[model samples]
Target: MVAFLDEGGMVDFTIEYELTPDEVGRALHRGLKLQLRAVRLAVPTILAVSGITCLLVDAIGLGVGMLAGAVLFPFVLAWSARRLAKRQLTYLCVPTTLRFTDDGYEYRTDQSATTMRWPLFGRVVSTPEFWLLFVGKQCSAFLPRRAFTSEQQAELDGFFAARQKAGAL
Candidate 1:
């Protein structure tokens, strides 16, 4: 179980979990959706255009193939992303702990620790299963919803909302 503490003027929490390949895959997919909206849309649009162009050129089989490929693009993309995420996870499968505080957040593993100020996070994205903190165009960390109790989740949500309102995110 995770723990939340209030000390001085700061509210903090500590989370420890073994990083899993499936989790990594989900994170990658979420990051892609959040950061590459145009690219995602363009791939299908380009494929559809190729399909139409092939039909105009009287290449029935090629047009059908392009159309079919467009239809299957999402599945193919997800499969490839999962494969890539799994490969990347091989080096990241470590027991990790994250500490969230009013000033910033800290990430720790057996070998090293790193901290970043709250302003460094560019955005906060909440999915049903995880809250992804993005730094620049990539996700820096993801906190699973299951790690927090309902009350704690509410507190965390409120904290983020307040930060967003202040233009801190």
Candidate 2:
């Protein structure tokens, strides 16, 4: 998968990348499980904290209610947001192909293919939503979980581990 920009920031190439069904299925399962866990953990904590705060604060019982509501609202919204984000991240429909070559990996997006060597990546991180390959503090690649399989996920883990070993990302 190579996604790049020209001097003018115009997209050069983009495509619906491919991945095996098994890989996509595994990634989706993992992403779903993680998001569910997050929702469960957050919901109880929000309720517990708010309940305590409301009981302890005589002047701001309303504040506690509002705080809890605010948190819970997002949890509700996250149900859909997580679903969409997971689909994009996991590449369930179309996986972005990334080729690891000597110069670095090439990733093709909808409009362009960009190449970045390992040395250019300053850090790498993963969440239930994305596999982030950072170029620096402000620049990065956001690969969705929906776009990869279990094997690919393992491959990415190894890639990042190698980067850490080399003191790159």
Q: Give the per-residue lDDT digits (tens) of candidate 2, residues 1-169.
A: 3344457643233334565555444444444444456665676677667767776776377657756775676567556645655565443345455655434667764645677877887776676656656655533455555555655566667767876888966
How high is each candidate's TM-score?
0.82, 0.45
The runs of at least 3 residues in candidate 2 whose Cα sits more than 4 Å from the true structure, single-residue gaps closed, are: 1-51, 60-67, 70-77, 83-96, 125-159
Give the number of the best model, judged by TM-score: 1
**Backbone Cα, N, C clashes tallied per candidate:** 0, 31
155 in model 1: Cα distance from truth in Å? 1.4
Worst 10 residues of 2 by lDDT: 9-18
Best by lDDT: 1
lDDT of each: 0.80, 0.58
Instruction: Give the per-residue lDDT digits (tens) of candidate 1, residues 98-131.
Output: 7888888788888778898889888888887788
Clashes of 1: 0
